[model samples]
Target: KIQRQMGSSYHPEVTMKIQVPFEEFTLQIEGRADGVMETDEGTVIDEIKGVFKNLDAMKEPVQVHLAQAKCYAFIYGE
Candidate 1:
């Protein structure tokens, strides 16, 4: 639904694989971004999630969901 609205501006199902260094070793993270868009300012990583709650009542993004978006952002930034 939202994807249709975004149209050709967004590329769907972007696969990203990144390795992050921890204290002793590296951690490999791999995931697919819902959508990605390139704007004049910068690249935009779109992370879409389905919600059962009413949209009208929602005030903020879920922490885990936001984290997921950040992961994509980090992957792209690197």
Candidate 2:
């Protein structure tokens, strides 16, 4: 859903897979971003999240989602 939105907005010229390592943890995070968007401002990373349930139930999960996006932001330097 979000990815689709980002894709529609960016229309990236290329798609790539990437893996990043977190030194603070002992796990290797892995996933593919939708694509990169090149703009006059800078490069942007697009992430997509889809929720299909009560909105109230999303509060707890939102934290984790934000954390993941933050990590991605840090790792990818977006």
- TM-score for each predicted model, relative to the true structure: 0.80, 0.48
Pairs with steric clashes in candidate 1: none
State the local distance difference test value for candidate 1: 0.87
List, residue by residue over 1-78, the lDDT tens digit for candidate 1: 666777677788999999989999999999999889887798889787899999999899899999988888988889
lDDT of 2 by residue, 1-78 (tens): 644766555643333334545786555555555556756798776667788889876646678777766665565662
Worst 10 residues of 2 by lDDT: 11-20
TM-score, candidate number 2: 0.48
In lDDT terms, how accurate is model 2? 0.61
TM-score, cand. 1: 0.80
**Residue 41 local lDDT, model 2:** 92
Off by over 4 Å in 1: 1-9
Clashes of each: 0, 0
- Model 2 stretches astray by more than 4 angstroms: 1-27, 53-61
